[model samples]
Each structure stands twice: as structure tokens, then as C-alpha cells.
Target: MYQYTDFDRHFVRQRAAQYRDQLERHLRGELGTDEFRALRLQNGWYIQRHAPMLRVAVPYGELSARQLRQLAHIARTYDRQPDGPFAGQGGYGHFTTRQNLQYNWIPLVDSATVMELLADVDMHGIQTSGNCIRNITSDAFAGIAPDEIVDPRPYAEILRQWSTLHPEFAHLPRKFKIAISGALEDRAAIGWHDIGLQLKRDDAGHIGFQVFVGGGMGRTPIPGIEISPFVAWDHILVFIEAVVRVYNLAGRRDNLYKARIKILVKAEGQKFVDAVNEEYRRILADDPAGHEQLIPQAELDRVKASFVDPAGVKAEPAVTLDDGDPAFARWLARNVHGHRLSGYRAVTLSLKRVGIAPGDMSADVMDTAAALAERFSHGELRVSHRQNLVLPWVREADLAELFQAARAAGFATPNAGLLTDQIACPGGDFCALANARSLPLAAEIAERYQDVDELVDLGEIDLHISGCINSCGHHHSGHIGILGVDKDGAEWYQLTLGGSDGSTLSGTTTPGKVIGPSFAADEIADAIEAVLNTYQRDRLSGERFIDAVKRLGLDPFKTAANAVRVSTAKAPA
Candidate 1:
């Protein structure tokens, strides 16, 4: 929400003009594919399955309604080129499992124009799609959640600026993700982020963060280690610099597969981690405090004010969604959430529609959302790490109309917290980084379970799938986890149970076991059914699937899952 100062404005314009020239060269054949790949990534462009995909940074999932509107306009204008861009191939833009928007199937030569278009709106594509620091993500329910100890956005914004195009940290050994969640609940999936921070108010009445290090999912699954219990707000950026500095120097650079910070954290113990951070902090302390001194106290305050009205946006008395149409009542039950605003709500766009790929949205859809964001919401929209869109501020009275518009645009999926509402990465089908196909398996699990009544009866559960060990899909923290692995040249799934996403996050209770190969989506669904059945009959009353698995141990579930030999004991007829 921080207004772009003239300095910031001028800087972004310069960056955009620079990228435009690079794009022109890439198209003119002056830049080879390899060279262009690196440059395009730095500017948030990627060559995906269909066409070119442009990734727009959401900056830790924060957006101004105006910004959201602009994004929508770009999608509608660019993706749907009159008779539609690229004919039938291009439709919706993709909202990622992280905090960014991906518009795929873009014509290679025309992308520079798109970059210029975005720059006109006070935005840029820098570092968004790169191996550098991708979009800095935070808990979706950050400040507004009732249980938060302190708001963490001001800190996030500060880091957002410092990390943007910092020449020293741009190209690392591998990709890095960082998450900061203030809520007692870990909505940001922080456990899976490379660097996770939980904001807390110290006993001395100072706002600080509990720093977590390592913690990622890839070929190897590792949980974050809480390296420091109290890192004051002022030192947050400096501390991060230290961590990345160490990784940049020692993290594996020879093999792309083992290059992630996760491996480095694994190679070194927590004590060694502390020493690295301390050493860098001391060196930085000796300096004349360059960037820190440049950051004005007013900057933080300005960003704070940009946040959607924390005390409610409307002048009227509170009106809950239950007071309106039955549809709103249903949406509120699923997509809508309580905000710090007394009479306002943060509405979630559920990604769990039955047959559709959970997070797929056409470019036109993105445009529609931008229009609605302009007219109804605060001109801001946020993409949740769960792969859902969020309109963070809506007056209780406008709920019905807003719901109608979203439903028309195919944004209505009333299963935000339900079991079918899942998190999945682009598997072998889309991502070059994948070891196994994940989307088909996810679709299979989602469609196989047809009973809504049964799901409600079972209560809320977190189910996650990842194509490979890379924890991009957050497989490590799922109540029920399915990781795709390769064996004998065939794609296989590794099922894990009892992963937690809280402050004291836990890993899969037992080592994940490989499920059958090339199992259709339907069979995967049955596999889940079998796991649930084990929990249903054996679980103590009031115990959820995760708790039951934790209490009874993974052996029971393992035995029960292996019992379903893929051919028989199916989920549905």
C-alpha cells in the first residue's frame, strides 16, 4: 500500500525500459535461449508448455484493489486478443500456489509490450519469476486474523524493497522462498518456506520475530529450524542478508538438484547456522548502516496506512453475511472470513471446483476480477499461497453483489477449508522441475471423493500433493501428504501422514512409503478413502485424521493403504 515516491517511480520506470531492450534482443536472436532464460527469469518470464508465461509479483500476497484491477485488465487485454490471443490456446491466467499471477501462452515477441503496459501501472516484473528471490510471501490471514500477536506487513514491505534487484543476491545456487506469518495459525505454509518468520511481541513490549532457518521440500523433505527466538524488527533484513550470504557462498552450486538452501541447512547444524548469521551481523554492524539509514521512519508508517482498513471500512453498523442471501450465507460459510474490520470481511476465491484444475484461471477471468476489484472491493486483490484469490475488504452489505460477480467469473468454489480444497504444484505435466505428474493425481483424489455430506461429517483436513520432493506444493505440512517420486523410470507416489503447519511444526510422522505407479486419479482417490477409513473406524471420538495418525502411529495407516492393491477396494463404483 505504500505510495510510490517519485524516486521509487523513477527507479521502476528505468527498470522497465531496461527490460524492454532485453526482450527486443531476445526476440531479434541476439540472445540465445540459455542467455535469454536467465534474463527473462529475472524479469518474471518463463517458457512453459503452452507459450510464454509472465509472472506478476504480489509482494507477499499484498495488492491494492487498484493494482488488482490493473492485473485483471492486463489479462483481459493481452490473453484475449480480440478473437483471443493465440486463438483457443490462451484463456485464463494462473494464480500460483505462492503469491504471484502467471499469464501463460504469451507470444514471445509481444511480451515486451506487456512489460511496458505493467510498468505504466507502477509495477514491474523484476525478480518475480527468477531463481533469485521470488515473490516474498506471508500468511494470507496476516494482520486481520484475531490470534495474531502483531502485524508483520511493515517488515515484509521493508524487505520487499531491499531484496528487489539487489545485485549480490540475484542469482543463487537455487530458488529460495521466505514466509512470514503473524497468526498463531500458520496460513502462509511457513514450514515449507526456506526462511520462515513468526512475528511476536516480546515480554519487553517490543515487536520482533522468531526466526526459522532451512525448512524446504524438494528431492529431500526438511522442516524449518527455529534458529533464533527473538530477532528485533530492525535486524530482520540484516539477519536475512546473513542467511542468504552464507548460502550464496557455501550452498551447492555444481549440481542444480542439490543446490537449494535446504541442503546447506542440512549440511550444517543449528549451532553452525547461528555462527554464520552472527558473523555477518557483526560485519554489518561495523558498517556505516547504509540502507537502514536510508529507510525513513515515515516509509514504514506510509506502508502501514496502505493496508486495508484494519478497523473496518464502512460507516454502517456490522452486518454478517448470514443476514443476506442464502448464497452469501454459503459463501461466508466457505470463502468469507472475519477481518480486523468490525463490519467488513476478507472474501476468499475458493480453488476447489470439482472437475477444473484447482488453480487454473483464464486471462479473461483475471481481467474480470480486476474490474470487480476496481468497482466493489478496495481495488486490491491478494493471491493466497493456497492458490486462491482474495478480496481483502468488502462491506457486509455489498457481499451479495460481490458474490454474484465472482460466481459469474468462475471464482466461486465454496470449499476453502474443506478436504477437496487442496494444494498441488505443476507436476511433470507442466514444470520442467518435476519428477512425477501431480495434477492428475490431485484431480483423481478430488473427484473420487463425491460425498459432501461425508466430508462435512469428517471435518476439515489439509491434503497436499507435490510432483517432486521440492516442497513447492507444501507436501511436508499436510495432514495427508502425497509426494510424487520416480522409480524404475515410472512415476510413483510417496504417501506421508501427520505433517503439521504450526509454530512447532512437525514432519511426516513416519518415512513416506511409495504408492503404486501410474495410478489414475480415481485410484488415488480410493487410496485416500482407504486412509480415511482407517482413521474413521479406529479414531477416538473428536480426533481428526492428523491427530489419529499421530496418536496411533503410521503403521496402521500404512498397513491399511497397502491393503488397497490398486485393482480392488476402490473409493466409488
Candidate 2:
């Protein structure tokens, strides 16, 4: 993990003080709600359905055990639990898709105090929201993945520093998201971000990036188009600046809905590419030092040095486990992943426990995770894009003990990449923008498929649910996507199938196709079961859910889903 320098610490403290001053002014009537809106957003404060929400940045999803403890402390002190039969125990935090942590019950007056707490741990809410470049994400398995071409953490950190408060892009047309993937697998979902950088090796074994631009999801979901097939590692910053410059100058600013770079690219098409190329040429020509000045080698070296691989890990002979626990074996198969180093594996601590909101973590759970990370994973952890915490360097020998600890903490669900492990957003329960509640649907689906054998049969399914078209839950990229919609003031779900984040190694990513009419909330789980049943019955030997759906189109699955819905509607009362 990157250690915060004195300058970084000072900068965060200063930013927190500034925000505190702003909050005081707002409370004193020096600033009205409208006047304080932009300022609050920049500081990661949102006036939600019932209370204020605060989003704290976890850069590149890296967290030290100390930082995790601080986050737990913040949750314990600042968040509130509603009083009711449905009320959860207090001190819970929500992990978001962008690798940030959000608190839903923050009070307006306590915003500054929250920022100060984050600053103490070298974390902050800066650039987490508002029309600025948001948190930069990278492959969770960056340095340790077996198939990695290069570690993306250094480059991500460089981008984080450059874009944190860049005066030129502070108020761009809209917010921007950037993702970097070093592994052959597209775990970072690079295709759906505003800017995607995939590390690649040339024929001469030189490292560089394949740049994709204007990819985003919302009302208009589009995969990013490649702007540069290959960019030299040293010149990536220059290329990024060129892209941003073009978007800032040519993107629509009058209409908030049309202000994203994706809209500009969609409207202009090839013309946008030509403009970006022209800008790149101008930027290159303006550099007297031949683009080397953009990202100095020394700066790269400094960042790279911070990410040295862990030492003292030795290769061990392959060991077989005979714990006689089918549950343990199931967890090992799904939650554990291959590591670059032998005798070591990356373990995902699932937040998707049945009946709980996806990505929700209590304060005590965070402390347990921190302790486990420190004891077994070199005191470091990574947050996955799939809303789970990853112990990136756990030794295989520690597997049993770690599993037991995680299970006790409710983090060991043995359901990674399965139907029960779904990506979801905090919907109508928290966000004012949501059309319907998402957590209940996710819980119901998980409960329906709680049987271990059933999930294994389902196999590698990516089910995502979003409360609205904002697509915060990444429903557009799921194998079975559920989108919440409001029709005639009633909650309904629109199901989409065959969508994927695309495999970069195999070169395939397609958006989900809508199957049929939206179904009522009560019918959602059965509708999903019908789709699963159709896949199980029709799939060839050893075919995954998404692959089967791709081989066989939506018609069969649609038929089964509609049949279930219709049968339920016509059932005797």
C-alpha cells in the first residue's frame, strides 16, 4: 500500500479545514441550500431521501489495516440506525462499485468531523463526488495476478495525484471515471468506465496501454471505443490530457443530461476522434522535452517503489485439504483465486451475506477484516469492483484459520461469482433518485438459491440490480440484469439478459438485451428462477449461464419467464 507523505497529510488536513469552514457558513445562513449544493457535493455530502450521505474515497481500492480501523471508527461514531422492526444494528457502512465507502445516515452538521476523521487516516472525500474526476480504480489483483503484464497500481497512483485537484479539469462537463486493468481478465470492468486503460505488451516486450474512451452506462449505455490501439507507457498522461481537453472544449454543457463525454462521442462519432487526435498532436508539439516532462521517470519510480511485492513468502508443495466440510470446499473453489506467487492466493471476503444488503458492512466486521488482513495478508487488503473485500496476499497455509475467522465475522459466504453473490446499489431505501428498493430483491434472489449445489449448477453468473437508469449497480453489464422502474406509480423490474463486462483475453463484451415487459416486484425472484431453469434444462454439458444464454438467444428464457409470471397472476387466491 502507498504510504502518505507529509505533503499528502498536510493537503488533506487543509482540505478538511476548508470544508469545515464552508459548513459553518451554511449553518450560519451565509449560504443557502442551493448555494451550498456544489460545495457539499465536492466534499462528498449528498442530501439523500432521509439524511445526508457521505462517500469516502478508497484510492485504487487499497486499504491498510490501520485505515480499515479508522473507517470502522467513523462508522461507529457518525452513522445512525433507524428505529423500527426493520432497523439494522447501527454502525454499518456501504461499499460502492467505484471502490468507495458510503455512510447513509450522516448528519449535516457532522460532515466536517467526518472529513477530519478520514484525514487522520490519510483518506478523504475529495473528488469522490461532484463534476470532477472521481476515484481511479485498477485491477484488484494488480501486482499478484498470475496473468498480469504489469502492475497498474503505480500508474493508477500517478493518475490519482495528477487528477486529484487539477485546476484545468476541476469543473469539466461532467464527472469522469478512469479504470486500469493489468491482468488479461477484465475484472475492473474497463469497458464501462469513461476512460479505460488496459496494459499490453508489444512484440518487443515493451509495456504500454490500450486506451478506450467515452464508455459509460446510464440512459445511454455504450462500451468505450479504442482511441489509441497502443500508447507508450511514458506518454499515457499526454494522451489522457488530450482526451480530456477535447471533451471539455467540445462537450455540451447546457443540458446536464447530455454533458457526459459519452454523449459527445455518440453525437459526433468519428469527428470526435479526429478532434482528439488533433489535440494530441498539439499537446505533443507543445512539449519541449518530448512528453517526458508530463510524467517524469523519477516520479514513476517513486510510486513504483511503494508497491514492492511482499517478501518472506516461500513456495510450498501442493497440499490437499480433507476437512470433510463440503461448505469449506465450496468456499475454497469460489472465494480463492490464483496468485503470481506459489503457495499464496487472493481471498475475497464476501459482503453478500443472505438477507443483508449487498456491500453493507458493520463496524465490527470491518475491524475483524482488518485484523485478519494484518495477521495473514501483510496488513493490506483490496476492495473488488464486485463489492467485496480482498486479502490480496494470503498464504495458502493460512486458509483454514482465515476461513473460520471470516465465517465467524459473516464474511465467508462461499458464493463468489455465483447467483447469490450479486452486485447491487443502495436503492429507494437510501438514494432519492431510486425508483424502487434493490436490496430486498437481491436478498430474495440469494435466499432462493442458498443451496450450494444449486449455485454450483448455475455457475459463474453475474447478476446485477439497479434501482434506476443511472445504472449505479452496473445492471447493464450483468448476465441477468434487473432494472427498477416506476410505472403508474408502481414498482416494476425490467429484466435484461446476455450482457457482460467482456473478457479482454477472449475479446468479447456485449450489453444486456431486454427480455420482455417489466414484472411486478413480487414476481421478480420466480421470474429469475424461470430463466435459470431454462438455462439448466437447455444448456449443453459444462456450459456457464452467460455462455449458454449467448449460444441460445433470449426467446427461450423469455418464454419461461413470461410463463411463470402469467401462471402466478392466474393462480387461485
Top model by lDDT, which number?
A: 2
Q: Tell me which residue pairs clash in candidate 2.
A: none
- Which candidate should be chosen as best, given TM-score against the real structure? 2
lDDT assessment of candidate 1: 0.72
Give the clash count for model 2: 0
Clashes per model (N, Cα, C within 3 A)? 20, 0
Alpha-carbon local distance difference test for all models: 0.72, 0.87
Query: What is residue 318's positional error in candidate 1, in angstroms?
Result: 3.6
lDDT over C-alpha atoms for residue 319 of model 2: 55
lDDT of 2 by residue, 1-573 (tens): 787899999999999999999999999999998989989898889999999999999999999899999988887787886742125555778898989999888788888998998999999999999888999998778898999888999999999998998999999999999999988788898989889999999999988899999899888889999988898888888889899999989888999888989999889999998998888888888876775546778888998988987667666665566568887888899998998888889999999877678888887788889999999898899988889999998888889988898898888898998888899999988899999889889988888888889888878888999999999999999998999998777788999998888764213666799887888888888899999999989999998888788789999999899886755553222
Per-candidate TM-score against the hidden true structure = 0.88, 0.96
Runs in model 2 lying further than 4 Å from the true structure: 83-89, 291-293, 314-318, 504-507, 566-573
